[model samples]
Target: MAPAGLLDAFWGYERALMANDLVALDGFFAPGPQTLRADAGGILVGHDAISAFRRGRGGAPARTIGDVHVRRITDDTAVVIAQTLPSTGGRGQQTQVWCRTTDGSWVIEAAHVSQPAAAIAAAVWRVVGSPLVAGAASGPLVGQTVAVKDLFAVAGFATGAGVPAFLAARAPAGDNATVVAELLAAGASVQGIAQTDEFAYSIAGRNAHYGTPPNGAVPGAIPGGSSSGPASAVALGQASIGLGTDTGGSIRVPASYQGLWGLRTTHGAVSRAGMLPLAPSFDTVGWLTRDAATLELAASVSVDAAAQRSLEPSFVVDPSLVALATPEVQAAFASAVAGLSVTSVDLGDPDELVEAFRVTQAAEAWMSDGAWVDAHPGALGSDIAARFAVAKGITEGQALAGASAFDGARAHLDRVLGDRILLLPSASSAAPSTTAEGAELEAIRGSTLRLTCIAGITGRPALSVPLMTVPVETTAAAPVGLCLVGPRYSDLALIALGAALMAPLVE
Candidate 1:
């Protein structure tokens, strides 16, 4: 039989975990650099790293212990095997190695946890299957699986658009969207329809109807959205390709936050038939992948070959744009840029351009969804609702003025960036804490939009390459993408260049 004191210590540790008592939980773990804790996300080494993770994680999922089994390895060392019954309906297993210290107190020296695979994560996927929609028998994309953004039309499924009321009002699509059909024809099957920000309006991926998706790279950070679902699915290895859209920074932001390669195709280069529109003027089809190779393959089938163009190898850096990122991101960018062949140039005031883009985007958003929003009151979350309120009041004169300013900015950027690639940070910072809200979230969003609007205004292809890592309070390090903005119709070439740059570093 197992010693009484060891069992008592095990139950005490469980109590501390249930109560989320950080101090008590820390004490339960054998203190030193040799301590370890691991889960599906990754491993945490040393007591300090494990402690830091616990502080940031709001708490463990509520679960009850059952079926405890014990084995004695030695007089002072034992193993505890316990079954966990999660409230969400799943059986999990946890294994721990306990050792008695000189003081005669038992503590965990190492631990590992395994949870039952969920059929679907409600926050990331609206619907899923073993193979939701099968692909063709053979093609270049054979064996690849795709996560179609909820904004896309999949045959036999109604596009949810991340709002329950909107989803309830729609009918099942008779045919797949052009992009979805192209991917399927290329031998890629659909994994499932993933979630998005409501109406694809918000960049921050928190949906009021469905919960926010988890950031695959950073355990307790918000997943960048409106392409939030697909990005998360791809990052977590649930799908090989994340078929999404980038109206503003939807694709690039999430890619940067999740350490994936994302591409925002040139406007009008890929057909958007059957897809919901947030801002048609800027809306463009895109995809996210874990590596540059998969991203290239996915883009090859969908993008128009006739529109493909080659870009000059030369790269340019706009100091004004780089200044918009956080200090940590700025430092990482500087380090990454030092090794590359790049020229410094000024792109003028970013705030002025951001303001112009915001005004026009808001107007377009109102035109696309204002009627529905008015017809169904209280349909949207507070952040998007407030944005629509401002959009509702935009005068015709203001929209025209904003359009004129945006046109001028685009023309100027086109002339300056003729054939050279523009390099900048993909986001203002690494993913923000999930608990971040109110003005703090808005400030981060505003800063990022300034950097992202450059490509949005120019109608050029932009690729977010996971080339830099920045330190964060939540983890040892978080990835920040180095964005590459190429000339119009340079989507394919952009992907190739990114893959080449990433190859050496990954090797």
Candidate 2:
């Protein structure tokens, strides 16, 4: 016997199809500014193709749905293998993978309405999905699974950093880092290393060697940052959490784009004994997770013993800067702020602060990559080369000037942050479109470093939380993240504030 809601379910879906009777089938699809779309049948995206798929050879039935076995693929999505009741054929099989939406809907985010695609999709999806058992582990994190960025050293596995030469040059590490050792002792699991950009330098996650992690929520968008692997791993539900480092915006950028939560604590708050150094002053270990509370768990285990002093995320939002946010992002931010008594303030003259950040980052990055840059001038990407060149001409006078200016920024920071925290944008806007580095890239980098530089300059702790998002035609775009920064040794305080902020976000 069919369930009581059986007819209701069928009718609801059927009514949506019938509603398009007079309205063209294409009308149901989100509007396209006329970019051609090709269906599985290979026709251009207009009303014709959409209607054909719906009409089914001569008005037989809207696309058929048969009983395909449903299998959970990731924390956010599930894949079901079944047959499509075809209009022409006797029977045709398909796989429907449903991903969870913020509003608690599991929609067909990706449908491999065929067998071959489903098989390949299922295998690779699983790698990016759940039930990840650590392939490399002596103990704890071994069976308890954790996803590591390709940037970290793993004994047998090549550290590609998404570069072929890097992979070839690497005589793999003989043993795990002491951090990995600790995780093992704690009975945690170690998932395989995830992907990162070539050289682990770029803010965008495009890697010429290993492919970038697909946007977990968006179809044709970038997955921001160097620590991008762990963000995708957690977002896709493959691993409970992911580990990555932040120098500029490595960890937070990806976390912001993926709508996951991340925290870049005080510079010296975490140990860096074995991690690769990008900029010793700014390079800090951080974790990515689904929520603020889970983030606290990682912080407790990871922060340097002496650095784990009093901490709480003081509410801070610059309404002026917050207003410039994208409409959707603004809505997201506003929704997060509602019902919470956050102390808002304007951080005037963030200019000198941001400049100090540039001077310091470029100088240190030059030290980190300058040697390779000299031998392989042509090998360096133009954007990175441009940044390196800025470092080459920094006179001692300029460095001193930068230091003095940074001191001023610190004074301003001290006056403003007296027992209080300020909320700010993680990035100025939402995720940029699927385009290469351009005006959008320039704007994003400027805004990200500007806000991020505050913590860097003060050597304080900061956390980025994905409290809001804007819906695109087919999926959601990563929105402005609410960040909390506190004075040095206040890593735990920032975590507390993050915990405090969560209620207002979804309430």
Candidate 3:
């Protein structure tokens, strides 16, 4: 039997709907693809769509629900059935499946309306929402939809960073993130905030608090994190562009996994105002799109170009780093860049480079969230908790040493690639299986970061072009990204170059 309080809540929802109170009605549904509503007029899928429907429909016929029967499906789930007597109707029925979230709030996950079936079919959408509309202005991205990673604050919404506790505790943002505001000003409609790894920590897409966002690019494969949601959303066609933050390949890794065009802008190229901090030193705003041209369009809207640099066909390939790719990836990359002139460059030991970046990033991650962890012990996912525990061991001296090493590497790269780009695999391997765990997962993270950390260490721009696919056990071939790192403040040039390089391959 459903609780008496739940029955009261159901009645409250009925009142809100009857009154056509958009704000009050919105409170009744959960905020993701898990929420669904179907009615004779049309099916309104997702919270945003439902909200929009409510706003557009205006006042509905007055109706009174009676003879309500609520059945408990579980302690946290229930079904509500009721008789609806509309003021102008013959007969009607409503059924709702309600679920209780961790915060002990009841929300409608699925709903159905009948007896007016002849009137219309239900409008359906992938269940998700946190929509914020853009101003009515025409620009390059006027008709495009951009899904923002939850780390960036959208006005009137809270930054979740994929942690339930943090989300619950945070206040609604008063203003949009700098990048988000820029996109809106450029005439792109906001699609809704997408999930991210907790505090944008892990590179694996799975969130400890929230569930993993689906990787449409690779069936049964990881959707690389912490920008997982935006990448997955863009790849899945839920949105045309995905606005995300990249701190040590968060955007690049997910883009590779989802087979989208992802960019990690030059460090400090974009403002981070109103965005949650992970590792400030390595953090940068980036985005993903299905095609190179759209990627360039989004980049143009967001990037305030420091100076334009001409695209150079000659690229420096580090064979030692290229060898890090698995046989399948190696072959795909070789084929993808077959026509371009590539010259080998000695970038030094890859393992050492990985460690240097790791220690410094770990220290910074700890610096950003260590106090919070101490305050809310045991709230983090075990994997993240374990990583932070290790991070705590990184000493000040060690961080300094790591920084020194990174500076040396950056200087070396700057000296080597005078005006050319450095070409490498975006990740050492394709997206890992969802079942991958323990040492297996960590090993993948380790190998992947070895390649991803290069851009972070140098504070330069890096673009991941999904030019080929590599074999994975779960799927026939998982998409692989070929990374191109360029000089500092050369973000626009990199995007143009990426488009030029990818056009011949994907187009």
Q: Which candidate number would show the highest TM-score if scored against the true structure?
A: 1
Q: Give candidate 3 regions above 4 Å deviation.
A: 1-131
Winner on TM-score (1 vs 3): 1
Q: For candidate 2, lDDT tens digit of each residue in 169-250? A: 7677666655554554555666667777655677776654455565565444567777767777677666766777888777
Task: Order the candidate numbers by lDDT, best to worst.
Answer: 1, 3, 2
TM-score ranking, high to low: 1, 3, 2
What clash count goes with each model?
0, 19, 7
lDDT of 1 by residue, 120-161 (tens): 899999999989999999998989999999999999999989
Of the candidates shown, which would achieve the greatest lDDT relative to the real structure? Answer: 1
User: For each candidate, what TM-score against the reference?
Assistant: 0.93, 0.72, 0.74
lDDT of 3 by residue, 265-308 (tens): 98888889988898888999998999878888888876776554
Q: Give the higher-lDDT candidate: 2 or 3.
A: 3
Residue 101's lDDT in candidate 3? 78
lDDT of each: 0.91, 0.62, 0.80
